[model samples]
Target: MPRKPTNIIYSANEKPPAGTVLILGVQHATLALLFIVYPLVAAAEAGLSFDDTQLFITSCIIFMGIATLLECLPRPGAGMLLVQIPNMAHMPLAVQSLAAGGPALYAGMSLVAAISQLTLSRFMRALRAVFPPEVCGVAVTMLGVALADPALRRVFGISGAITPDLDLRYALVSSVTLVIIVGLAIFSRGMLRLFAVAIGAAIGWILAAYLGVAPEPNASFATLPYIDIPHLGWPGVSFFSWALIPAAIITGVLSAVDMVGTVVSMQRMDDADWRRADLDQAGRAIQANCLGDIGTAITGGFASASSSAAVGVAFATGTTAWRVGAVSGILIILAAFSPRLIGVLTIIPSPVIGAILIYAAAFLTVAGMELILSRRLSDRRIFTVGLAILTGLAVAILPGLVGLTPEWAQPILESPLSISTAVAIVLNLVFRIGIRQEASREVTTADNPFTVATEFLEYQGDLWGARRDVISMAIPVVAEGVEMLLDTGVAPGKLEVRAHFDEENFDVALLYEGEPITIPDHRPSPEDLLGDAHAVARFVGYMLSKRADRLVLGTDGTREKLTLRFEH
Candidate 1:
C-alpha cells in the first residue's frame, strides 16, 4: 500500500533560504565550468580563432545564467520554475553538426531545432504513457553505455582503436588528480564531497602547470571586436543532415523525460505531495532550453539544456530564494565583460577535464543500471530489455556490425541517443505485444486465488513472525488485504492473527493511532487441524462481532503473525 502524505513547510515565495542559494550557486559554477570545457576545446580544435573562442565562452556564460534564472524564476506561463542544467546529451551531436555546417549553419540548425521543440510542447504529455519507467530506464542506460567510448577517447586522446604513444606524463598527472579526488570524496564529509570534482580539476591544472604542459592562464578582459547579429543561414536539409532531425527530437524529448523524473524523485524523497501544477511547472522550466538555445545559436555556440546542477545547488544550500538566480546572472554578466578570463578557461587541457568527465559518465551508467534493476522485471522481460540495450549500444560503439554504408546511414547512426531511442521503442513494443497471447492463455486457466493464498502463506512464514502484530503488518499488505482487515473491525490499534497450514506462513498488521501493536501468537498443535479460508473467515467474523480491540494468531517469532486493530 502507498504511504500517506506528510506536511512539510516550504517557503515557495520570495527567494529560497540563504543557505540553499549558496550551496546551489557553488554547485552551478562548478558544473558550468566543467561542462563548458569540452565545447571550448572542440571549437578551438575546429580552427576557431582565439577571439571567436572567447566570444563563444562569453555567450555560454550568458546563456547559462539566463536559462538558470528563468527556470528558477518562471515568467507566468513561460518558465518551468525548476532548476535547469546544461544539456550534456546534445554536446556530441551539436559538435558534429557544427563541424559539418560551420558557424552559420550551426546557428541556423540550432534555431530551427529550438523552434521545433517549442512547437512539439503540446504533444509532450502524450508521450508519457509510451515512455514509462521501464522504457526510460532502458533508454537512459543505453545512453550511458553508448557514451563510454567517447569519454575514454577524451581522457586518453585515442582515435578509434588507434592508441597514440602513451603520454605518460599527462597520464600520471591525471591519475594523481583522480586519486586525490576519490580520496577526498571518501574521507571528507558534507560539502567537501560536493566540490570534489572542482577541487580535483584545480589540482590537475596546477600539476599540468608544474609539468610545463599547461599554457599560462589568460587574465585579461578584452571585448571581441566583431559582434555580428545571428543572421539566418541555410538549414542542413540534405539527406545526411536531415537524418539528424530525429536525433535532435529524441534529445529534446528525453531531456524533458529526465527532468520530469528528477522532479518526481525529489518529491518522493522529500515525502511531499505531488500536485498537478508541479508537472506543468516542470514543463515550463524546459522552456528555458528554447530561449537558451536561441541565444547559443546567435552567439555561435551549442544549444543549452536544463541544469541538474541548479537543482542540487538549490537543495544543498536551501537557496530557494529567487535572488540567487539574479546573483548568478550578475556573475555571468561580469564574466562576459572579461574576455581574458574566458580565454584562460578555453585553454584547460582536455585530459584534465576528460578525467572528470569519465568518472561522471561512469556514475551515470551505474545509475542507469540501477534504474533498470529497480523495475524488478521478470527474467524474460530482462532478456528482452537487455538485448535491446546491447543492440543499441553495438550500433553506437561498433557501427560496422550493422553493415550499413556510412554514406547512407551515417547521419542516423551518428548519435547514440537516436539509435538507442529507436531500438528501445521498437523492442519494447515487440516484447509487450508478443507476450500478450501467451499471457491470455495462461490467464484463462490460472488459479489466481490459490496463487494469492500460497503467496500470502509463504510471505507469512518467511517475512512475518507468529508474534508479529497483524495490524502493523497489514499496513504494508496489498489493497485487497487492507480492505479485508478494515471489514474485520481492525481499527487503528487492534491486532489479529490468521494462521495457515504449517507449510505456509501468514502475517498482517493494522495501524492504530500512530502506533502499532503485536497480536498474541496462534500456534496449532500436532493434534489440532487447521481450518480452510471459510473457517478462518468465520473466526475473524466472530472476533469482529465481539468488537475485540486486539486479535493475535500464529506462533511468536516463528513467522505467521496476523494481527488486527479495532480502535484508534
Candidate 2:
C-alpha cells in the first residue's frame, strides 16, 4: 500500500539562526584540517616540487571553497540543499593512484570517474530500491573492514614497509596516544567529547615533540604563496592508467553509500518521512558530488564527500538558519592565498594524526557494522553478508594472492569495495527476492477473532456478546468540536466523551457517512490518542461506517453518530 501523506512540513522558514554560522565555520575548519592534510601530503609524496605542491594545494583549497559554497548555499534548483565537503574515503585510493601515475593521469582518471558517476546519477533512484537498508549496511561495513589495516599501519608509523626491527619510540608514542584518546572519550562531556580525537592528537604531538620522536619541522615558510588556477591535464587512458579505473569507480560507489547513510540519518534526526521525492533529492546530492570531483581533479586533489561534521555542528549549535557555504568558500580562498598554512599543518607528527584517525576510523567501522546487523535479516542472510565482508577484507589485505590469478581477473579481484558491493548486491537479490519467505497467517474480518468480535458489536449493539454504543450520539458532536477543543489545549484522553466511549465499547469504533465502520480490535492507549490527537481523530474519521442503516439513534432522541462517549 502507498504510504499515507505526511502533514509534517520542512520549509526554509524552519532554518537555523545566524549565530549558528560561527559554530558551523569552526566545524568546517576542524574537518578541513583533517581532510586537507592527506591530499597535501600525497601531493608532496607524488614528487611534486615545493612550488608545484603550493600551487596544487592552493587550487585544492579554492576548489573546496567553491564546492562548499555550492553545497551550503540555498541555490534555486541547484545544490544538494545541504552542506557537503571533500570525501575522505576517496583520498587513499586517489593518493595511491597518484603514486603510480603522475598528477595528470590521476586528474584524467578522476574526470572520467566523475563523468561516469554524473551519468549514473539518473539511474540512482531506480537502483535505490534494490539496495535496501540491509544491502547498503553490508556494503558500508565491508568498506570499513577493507580500510582497517591501512588505518592501523598509519597509526603505528609503519607506512611503506613493515619490518621486524620496529621503532620502540614510535610504538610508545602510538600507545600513549591511544590511551589518551580512550581516556578522553570515556571521561569527557559535550564539546570535549566531540573533539576528543583532535585533542588527543594535540596531546600526543606535544609529548612526541618533547621526546624528539616527531618529524623535523621544516619551518622555512618561503614557498609560492598565491592562489593558483587548477591545471587541467588530459589523463592517459592507457592500460596502466586504466588499472586506476577500478579505484575511481570504487570512489564513486563508496561516495554514494556514504551519502545514503547520511541521508537516512538526517531523515531520522528530523523525523521526516522518506518519499520518492526524497530519493530524487539524494540523486541530486550525488549529482552535486560530480561537481566536487571535477573541482578536486582539476585542482590536483582527490574527490570529497558530505561532511558529517557539518551535520553534527548544525544539530549541536542549532544554526540551521544561515548559509555557511559562503564562510567555507572564503576560508578556502584565504587558505589558497597562503600555502604556508598547508605547510604549517604538515608539521603535526604523523603518528599523532594517524592515532586520531585510527580511533575515528574504528568508530566509523564499528558503526557501519552495527548498521548491517541492526537490519532484521534471517540467519542465512546475516551469514552471507558477513562472509562477503570478510572476503572483501581478505582481498584488501592479500592483494598479492589475488594478483596471482589471471591478469584479466585482477581488477575484479583486487578492488575490495567493488567486490563487496557486488557480493552484497547479489546475495541480497538471491535471499530477499529470489528465494522469498512464505507468507504467514493472514488477518481479515472473518478470520481474525478480534475483527469478528468488533464487527458483531457494531451490527447489534449490546446483542449476543456485543458491547453497547450508548455514547454514539455524542461522537459526531465531539468529532466536529474536536478541532476547536484541541486548539484550546483540551487533551483528548482527558475529555469526558473520549473516556466514556473507550469504556463502553469493547473496541473503538467511529461512524461516518458512506464509510465502513468497524471497531478496531487494538485501540490506541490514552497516551497514544492524546499525544497525536489529530492523527487519531483522522484515523477514526477514516474508519467510521458511512452506511445510513449502520448508525443508531439514542433513546434521548440524539442523532447516534460515532462518539467518544461510552460506559465504563
lDDT of 1 by residue, 1-568 (tens): 1222332123234445566445545545544554675567667666666656655655666776676666556463233224334466656556666677666655666666677666655555665434544455565565556556655665665645765576666676677667766666557655555456657778988888888766554444244322333222223332246756665665565565555544433333233332112445545655656777777777766566654434433333322344555555555545555445445556776667656655545544554565554433544456656776776767776767556654435444555545665566665566555332111011111234234434543344232112223323333332233334334333322322233311112223322221122322343333322544333444443434334354554344522334533331
Each model's number of backbone clashes?
52, 15
Residue-level lDDT tens digits of model 2 in 468-562: 23324333433443332233232322121212111113222222222222344455455645644454553343334231123231222221234
Which 10 consecutive residues of model 1 have the lowest summed lDDT?
Answer: 436-445
lDDT of 2 at 275: 20
Alpha-carbon local distance difference test for all models: 0.50, 0.52
**lDDT (Cα, 0-100) at 525 in candidate 2:** 58
lDDT of 2: 0.52
Off by over 4 Å in 1: 1-27, 34-60, 73-105, 157-161, 216-282, 298-301, 306-330, 399-412, 434-450, 453-568
